[model samples]
Target chain A: MIRSEQIEPCAAAEHSGAWARRHVLDIEDFSVPEIELVMQTTSAMKEILSRPLKKVPALRGKTVVTLFYEASTRTRGSFEMAAKHLSADVVNMTAQASSVTKGESLINTLNTIEAIGADIIIMRHPLSGAHYCAAPHVKANLVNAGDGWHAHPTQALLDLYTILNRKGRIAGLKVVIVGDVKHSRVAHSNIWCLTKMGANVVVCGPPTLLPEGLKTAQLLFPGIGVETNIEKAVKDADVVMELRLQKERMQSGLLPGLRDFIAGYQLDSKRLALTKPDSIVMHPGPVNEDVELAADVLHGGRSVVNDQVTNGVAVRMAILYLLAGSREQ
Target chain B: MPSKVVITSDEMRRSIARMAHEIVERNKSTENLLLVGMRTRGVPLAKRLAANIATFEKIPVTVGALDFTLYRDDLNQRQPSVKGTDIPGTIDGKAVVLVDDVLFTGRSARAAMDALIDLGRPEVIQLAVLVDRGHRELPIRADYVGKNIPSSKDEDVQVKLAETDGMDEVRVASQE
Candidate 1:
């Protein structure tokens, strides 16, 4: 549950005049207070998740269409569960079964879903900014589940919620993001959100996997640190977030082999000892199990990996409830 | 615009004390009695009642806060400012006294009741309000009310409890 005392009342009659932003394109679109609002909403939604019935009719009759151009297991399941828990009708669309294979354009597909009376579109595409380009093409609200490597906002928000729920605050905490920093959309989104919430973020990876636009990250959220040394990056960190190593990056010669990557950066109990005793481990999972992380450490007491998965549903519920649940529509 | 003070601090305290005693008398005992307050103003009022019940019967009454922002019918018309909904323990077979500040169209009460039901199937759910203002759109009614004030549609009944507003008074003022 939320610390109601910590959140300013939902001054709906005052500052939320019109509350008309219908799409969640990226974390960059939200201010710190807005992010807090989402967190507070998620906390309330979590109570519903823990209920005996575990369902709320808040989104009754609302249609949430989840369109994923890329294959996913966790993100897709979480969104579907979140929508169903809120009593919204869910229609899942995938790239393989859809007419995209028959040459239907992205905008055409989105319009087709909108034409079928979908109220909201949650899309994850293989191309960066795919959701951005599709937003103006449909009347239904658009949620960027993930856009190539540009942003996987809900994942990041849920990660933040998980951290805040465990630690009680975000400001002044050191959060080290480890693994495929160059290709992991989860890492990109986390850096933007954690930094916005006043957490010091250090992105650590093998030099080949580190982004050439590292300067852009520092520019995006000033004071962001880039580190190649795993030990230095995690030292004194309040949180260590491990990203799943995309094995495809190996074929491209980003690293010599899985052994090299694991030896250099894979987080195990021994490596975890380098951080503060209370430091928590997190993963945006479908873990590379024992590759990017030691299987034992990922499931250890200090790991909030399972909590992240549970909070994923609550956080996505908040996103759908806020973006789709409105009387005016 | 001049506002009328319907209930003063002393009278409000006496009304709450009377309500507490009535609750004890009606329930026959404080055993398995839970007081659930709606968020914002209802929380403090519920706590006050629990405190008064403890003093009167020398027994502790469990108090919890419920936030109905997510359960409201008007979610589409406005942004919901969510609050904490914390029920200390299960109310499966207990008598729940749902507390709120004012009863107007009865929508908030209905929403809170809906939320409470989802949490657990309480043995019996009863609502208590400080002010029972006129013009309830729903057929809902409060089980215990401090005062019943006939009000016009445009008039807002404002209940100020010392815990939230730093004063104990009920005021009737025009919405304008």
Candidate 2:
């Protein structure tokens, strides 16, 4: 249970501005104030999670439909839990289980979900910009879980929340993201979110795994450092984030070999020693043990991967609460 | 809109001191007693009541803050941002006095009761308000009321506490 002294009414008063956006497509569309507002709301949701009775009646009559075209454990499960915690009815659908198997078009499938009276549609499609394509056709608010390698706004927000929870601040912190930067939607969204909040973000990966527009991205997100050297990237860092290495990338010849990648980028205890003493390690999970992150480092004291999962539910709850509330305002 | 001050700062303080005495007398003792204040102005008023009780009883009472934004019945019509509920300890078998600044329509009091029940099974629950303006839609009444100002449905009764509004006063103004 939360202490009565920790609950501050003035904190809620600071975010009196009404939420403006309807759909959460990407981190690029979010302003600084909007991101801060989400963080503040997530703090309140976290307090609810601490209670013995974890349910609330805020979204009593609303329905949430989660449509996933890709495989996800943490994101989908947390979103479902978030909706259930808020007392919103949730319907989960995967590509194999849904009408997508019957060759239903994305827009048509979305309309069908809308017809079922969904107040919010949380979808994870494999195609980039899918939420943008589906947002215009549906009356329900759209939240992109992950679109190809595009963006995962909720994941980014939770990562931000976890970082802020541990460090107590974000500005001027060095956050090094290591692994498949090109294929990881987590990295793409984190870059945008972290940079916007005044963090010095560094992307570390092999030349082939790094994004092609690295130079141009630096221009867009100022103070972003691209380092191929893993040791140099983690040096004196505040936060070291490890992106899961997708095994499919190896078949495409993007990497030399698994052993070679592990030798260079695996975040073992030795590699973790290079960062600041109080620095935290994060991984957007389904982590490949001993490949991207070593077993010891994964279970290390500095690891906040579990906290990230818990914060994911809170962040999603905040997103659903804000989006649903904005419709009436 | 024309408004007139109903209760001055001194009157508000005296009313809180009286309410504290009444709470102590009715409950027989402050043992296992909790003062849970509704969000915003109610929080400070609860603290003030607890402070007064501590002055006379020589034992401090536990104070908590309850935010019922999530338990609202009109959620589908409008959703307010959640401030959060924080109880210092378990409410099971404890006498809870819910403190608020004003009682209007009694809907918020109803919501607060529902919220409290969800947390734990309190031995008993009582409502306390600094002002009780008439026009209640629900069959709820405050156990401890500082003042009763009967007003029409179109009028608004506002309670400004020094902790929130930087002043202590109760005023009634007509809705424009």
Candidate 3:
């Protein structure tokens, strides 16, 4: 996390066309409208769902394969649901049952799926940007569901979608992302979105994960700041995004224990009390309630978990359609 | 700045009926046929297609209406605000035919497909449209199309079903 405003926004489409492209591997790749477009598209799509029958025909004849090298109930299901609504066939491959145990490389599996005639592949891997390495030979579109700590673009899209959805405007809001920023794809993506939407971004985590450089990524999205204290972070925040703490971090000695992590960084009732009364609280989770956030705060009025899950379909629908439909390859 | 309607009532019914016949003919049988209608006007059109297909092939059509409001990519632009999806049924390993009243820019269609995956996997999915007013923002096309009307960027194409609008029609309303 080096602080520098020296970098330039990637050239036109590289910056803008992310609104319509191949894979969503990171947050920095998208622009405001691109993110907003997905939200708007989902809104119209939701309108269609309000009726008696819920189905759409834009993806007829399309086949979307969701390959999760990791385990995810929310995102995988969200993408699956989005595909089904549009009348597209879906194939899911998660690690709970996969050929990886049988000794196949990520690239090999992706290429094999492409050969089998999948029109789109939505992948979630533990390695960062593993989707990029698989991009070359994947004859169909490649959608990165989650790749290591790199990103879960669709997750961020949904988070942004949920925020914009509840509030109508993302600009000028104060957003604070608490917890493990070092390893959270959710935090990384939300930082980009909240800041890009003109909200002030503050990343609060213990020093090691917080790092010195994140304060700089803030400038890219702009209006962002850094904080070491949990109290300071959520104080003026219009949105508080809390992330899960991987127990692995404790074993790796990132910290002593879940209790230690909670004492230092968790959004317990005391910390939650600091946020604006109407500010929204969001988590991309199977939450470790006591570990990263207190139970009461999570179940409180500010929590938008259900909305985030529901909006996940709309956001992924936007990502899948945008990436899968932009096929000239 | 808002969208307005085009096309007439009788024309909408004819287009839907025509699309129903085309879908039935291409699939060779209506046995595994499931009609998934895009939301708003598409839902009524799908019901109409089910009725028309039942008339044509002399069999019942499984009709399911789909709403893409939550799944659409253009939520903020909508005046009334969009809501989350609540689709019914299990689409796993079935031949599904998605029906929409109109096809323009293809963004709405793309979102609908993403929304589909949550329910279950489908064996075969095909798109049937009453109108194809082209200016595709993304690479998408309809399989069974009733009309291929040329449209300008500023023009809005609307399809009204008899149930909602009390008549069936397709119209092209241009921005003044």
> Top model by DockQ, which number?
2
- The most accurate candidate by TM-score is 2
Measured by TM-score, how close is model 1 to the native structure?
0.95
lDDT of 1 by residue, A1-329 (tens): 21232333344422333345688889877776678778878887887777768888788899999999999989999999999998999999999999999999999998999899899889999999988888777788899989888899999999999998888888999999998888888998898899888999999999998889998767877889999999899999999999988888889888899899999999999889999899999999888889978988987899999999999998999889888744334
Please say which candidate is ahead in DockQ: 1 or 3: 1
What ranges in model 2 sit over 4 Å off? A3-16
Give a tens-digit lDDT track for model 1, residues B90-115: 88999999999899999999899898
Model 2, residue A53: displacement in angstroms? 1.6
C-alpha TM-scores of all predictions: 0.95, 0.96, 0.64
How far is A120's C-alpha from truth in model 1 (Å)? 1.1
lDDT of each: 0.86, 0.90, 0.73
Q: TM-score, chain A, per candidate? A: 0.94, 0.96, 0.89
Write the candidate numbers in order of decreasing DockQ: 2, 1, 3
- Location of the lowest summed lDDT over 10 successive residues in candidate 3 chain A: A1-10
**Candidate 1: how close is chain B to the reference, as a TM-score?**
0.97
TM-score of chain B of each: 0.97, 0.98, 0.86
Cα lDDT tens digits, model 2, B11-93, are 99999999999999999999988999998688999999999999999999999999888788876666676667778878999
lDDT of 1 at B80: 61
lDDT of 2 at A129: 94
1 or 3: which has the higher lDDT?
1
